[model samples]
Target: MTLIPKSHPRAKSLLIREKLVSGFDNGLVAKEGLLAQGRGEAFDYLLGEKTNQAAKRAIKAAAAQLLQAQKPVISVNGNVAALCPKEIIRLSKQIKAKLEVNLFYTNEKRKQAIIKTLKKNGVKEILGTNSANSTKLPGIDSARRIVDKDGIFAADVVVVPLEDGDRTMALRNAGKTVITFDLNPLSRTSQTANITIVDNVTRAIELLISESKKLTKRNEKSLEKIISDFDNKKNLTENVIQIKNNLTRRARVA
Candidate 1:
């Protein structure tokens, strides 16, 4: 006799649960990934689902990069849409970045449904490319050619949330600034991003919007300084070391 049956009302969430379990089983998500997600969830809860200092800095740099762009593009995937739909639309408007829907799940009907959902939430322009989108950027294993009608290819900056490693590396190789939101600091996406926020999308986007609003027009130099000082590898290394030290200290105390 089980206290909680498999067919309980909570079973409805099984869809997302199964996806997470599968990701873990397949090595797409690791133990560290789960820990990161837990931290992000806590941050999200504490900030009222808003952003924080580190997240704000990352977002400001991202907005500045896009504002300085000749043609900015916001790469949208399913996770981004599900996590931060309204914020995505808001960020696009603030930076004038075009929305390009790129997903690993290559279902036409589902893609259309996502687009429709975004439009309903006030996203005016959403571009979906064919399954053959390819880039010269090394390590980018995109299933479709990323269509950049706004000349995203020519832009100096791209904001890619929950991005694939291959695309991030390729974008960097193309001489474009890539700002990304990733939970796992060790992941390829984090390693390749110019400014990688080790925070969840919900918190990251809100913080970015707030920072962008407070920024004046003549802060390009300051923004550039922020970008220049951001060391992705260093930050990630520091985070890992700190967590390990804390764990060790706790063990000794125990």
Candidate 2:
């Protein structure tokens, strides 16, 4: 990893890039994962590189939904393992949800690398690896369709961070509630998910953990109310408006 000066305006972004580069070198991230990160960064820029109010509402709703779930599973991919492995573990522990490594660019070596990273970060019994237990998700042809029976397959609610569109829609069709962290409000993953936190996963993951802890004290009725009140379509529309407002504001300043 390169040593970036704190005084640099792009220090945090640069550091995130370095992490992905290192992850690619270390076999924790696929080459395509780097490209996906760059794409998400562009959306992040449009949102002023910060968590917006719409995302906060989504996160709160996501936490409530997870809390109310019969069995919640958090899906980890290569980029997610590379970016926020520790936070993912923290969120899983906080919400009592299971962790499953489900990769799009799936290979045994990369799968083991991600599992090893999670294990090192205090995750035990990570799923979505055993072929005998893996079941195909309907409506997707990617290797990602393979899901663990005890993990994503059996989960009532699945938290898929940095997810692809087809699988998000497939999960919903399979009668599972899908919660996702996607930066682009217009992306299919955002539009299809039951609750979408339209913020960078690296930033919103910690907030999810914190919110999960805070909401744990509330009764099931209150948690249900939080989930019931949230409208995913309306939240995503607000996020799109936020990006447009930011662009319009910048246009005026220029």
In terms of TM-score, which candidate is strongest? 2
How far in Å is the alpha carbon of 249 misplaced in model 1?
Answer: 5.5
Please report, in order, the local distance difference test score of every candidate based on alpha carbons. Answer: 0.64, 0.92
Could you give me the TM-score of model 2 versus the true structure?
0.98
Q: Superposing all C-alpha atoms, what RMSD in Å does each candidate have to the true structure? A: 7.0, 0.8
Model 2 Cα lDDT, one tens digit per residue, 58-146:
99999999989889999999898888899989888888899998988989999999999999998878998778998888889999889
lDDT of 1 by residue, 70-113 (tens): 67778776555554678889888877778887655445654665
Task: Indicate the worst ten consecutive residues by lDDT in candidate 2.
Answer: 122-131
- The all-Cα superposition gives candidate 2 an RMSD in Å to the true structure of 0.8
After superposition, which runs of candidate 1 have C-alpha atoms over 4 Å from their true positions?
A: 1-56, 129-139, 149-151, 249-254
Misplaced by over 4 Å in model 2 are none
Q: What TM-score number comes out for model 1?
A: 0.72
